[model samples]
Target chain A: MSLAPWRSRLTLALERNPQLNARYLQLATVGADNRPANRTVVFRGFYVDTDKLKFVVDARSQKITQIEQHPWAETCWYFPESREQFRISGCLTLVIANYPDLALQQARQDTWQELSDAARLQYTWPDPGQPKADAAAFESLPPNPKEPLPHFCLLLLQPVQVDHLELRGEPQNRWIYCRNDVNDWSTQAINP
Target chain B: MSLAPWRSRLTLALERNPQLNARYLQLATVGADNRPANRTVVFRGFYVDTDKLKFVVDARSQKITQIEQHPWAETCWYFPESREQFRISGCLTLVIANYPDLALQQARQDTWQELSDAARLQYTWPDPGQPKADAAAFESLPPNPKEPLPHFCLLLLQPVQVDHLELRGEPQNRWIYCRNDVNDWSTQAINP
Candidate 1:
């Protein structure tokens, strides 16, 4: 399938501002209480072919549970220096240690291995959001490849809609792209 | 009522990192479709006495409608320089031109006046989230004080729970504060 025209534009924008694109993005997911919950997650990369935004998270994180209950999620990413914001809403799919798909499991392992040892240490810690006795306790547990942290998970957000807003220009510039059933995108310029 | 100990700590943190605290924060609200939607909003300030977070938006914004339908919302704020993150979840209350409370209406008027004329231009534009014919059209229409933009609104988030995470530490530091019925806060250290 041909790439969506807006996808190329988004890719070029990211290329021009690599620092902003790679920085932390705020991910919003519907909580069990039906309220919207949000937290910062590092933006890994975007897959043009599949139209998926990649990010890594601990398998046992509360966000994973939230996404499991409601696959729909939205992310707000702002490039401070560029004065641009991208609001992306989509459905999520998780790749975990026991993911049924072999290819996805292998991909998760590769991503896990690429993380720095210090970063990987987080996944080995006790369950997140749970009360901890002491911060010092985590120091005892280091990243151990032999014990493979089953909690390491890869998250993929397949975007159905993307709203881009450039706040630098006069009157600002805003556009929204909605993906169709066949994966083609229809774009509309909206007032900022 | 006396301020909660945790609230004081939060206040101190914001004071120490004023730039990061005052910058744009990501606000998450559940949309009409029951999907979590997110966008960046300017951080106005925190009301120490009332324990509320304040921000202003056009009354006709989709988020205003979203909050009206479901008062519960979440805000994710990250301070890159400080390597800190704050996840605040709460119920929202709106202060509009015709709000019943006299004090709130006065507060909204004060905030509207404080905004720069260029910033106030947004309220004068056509309803946001709707398609527009031309971006240049907004340039022709300036903020007219006599024709008060009735759509200008102030939003207050009374946080029920606040999660503070400091990623600068070795094991990282995480704490959550939940406000009880009497407005007192209970704090717990959680695994990061």
Candidate 2:
């Protein structure tokens, strides 16, 4: 059979993952000491039509620098007690800053509203090296139809390979699917 | 304030997360190439009494090897809609075969039985590199009235630091709680 069947399964699997929305993804990158450094990021959205995942990153975040130097990245998503998981590896690209997509930025702000009082404090103060924005920063921009942040850019990831892992028994089984150059996927049961 | 207050809060959080019984944890390790490699492992149980997180791993797994070489590791858990997350980093140790009570082993086995058919398939055909049951390997051996799988070991991680990330609207906040050598915890808010 043509690999179409497996491609369909892969697409469906991505859709089945409820955690894919605003999921917490940990990106591992090489640090100054050559040790692995990982931090959590919010998943903005996935383009099932294009088989691509989208996120936002500060142009100056340490991770952005690491990804630029080494494009290979691994992302992990976990939901407690849920039998769904995604361990994906792919190359990431910076969507041009001028991409007129305020919709994504609005959705991100909406999701941010759902956090607790304690959680809200985390973002009010940017981490060292993270792009800084102040109250005046938002005031200076014209409110005609968009919010302006010079450092804002959409980050798109085209997954090269994804391993869909389900909670089997003690020895977890993994279906490793790889996307061909043409964006089609092939699945194989690898040694879990 | 007494530390008991915070510990009690943690207890409530754990209760709210009962479904956490089955969680996917990403273990980041230094690969031979000096880059980071991550793998997902199911959390077996938590020793609340000892304040340790427990999980099973194949003695031959790459992560096990990595831990042997470098004990520093990070574990992360998140809920997408809740926008709440738990991140843990600390030293990890592998429990020897002669550990845990017989009752506990039986309880774990019972939980294993509750998994669905697809889940059962993962362990039935054991992966050589993962932890699994080998009935034939144990057939000739006398059933140890004490412990099952005398070769299997549970890995325990004593969290040195734990961070909570909350992504509510307007402001995002992160709180870090660190354990002193004396077992006392100090918590403070950090920039997100």
DockQ of each: 0.74, 0.20
TM-score of each predicted structure versus truth: 0.93, 0.65
The fraction of correct interface contacts reproduced by each prediction comes to 0.91, 0.24
Alpha-carbon local distance difference test for all models: 0.81, 0.56
Worst 10 residues of 2 chain B by lDDT: B137-146
Q: List candidate 1 segments past 4 Å from native.
A: A20-22, A144-148, B16-22, B144-148
Per-residue alpha-carbon lDDT of model 2 for A1-192, expressed as tens digits?
243333464445546655444255676555554545566777655643455667666654566677767666667755343454666777776654454566545544443344444433332234533333553332232221233244545666667777666665334555777788766777676555
Name the candidate that leads on lDDT. 1
lDDT at position A177, candidate 1: 93
Scored by lDDT, model 2 comes in at: 0.56
Residues A1-192 of candidate 1: C-alpha lDDT, one tens digit per residue? 676556776676677677643468899999888999999998776643566888898878888878889999999988776678899999999887889988778777777777777878777677888997565567656676544488888899988899999888677888899998977789888877
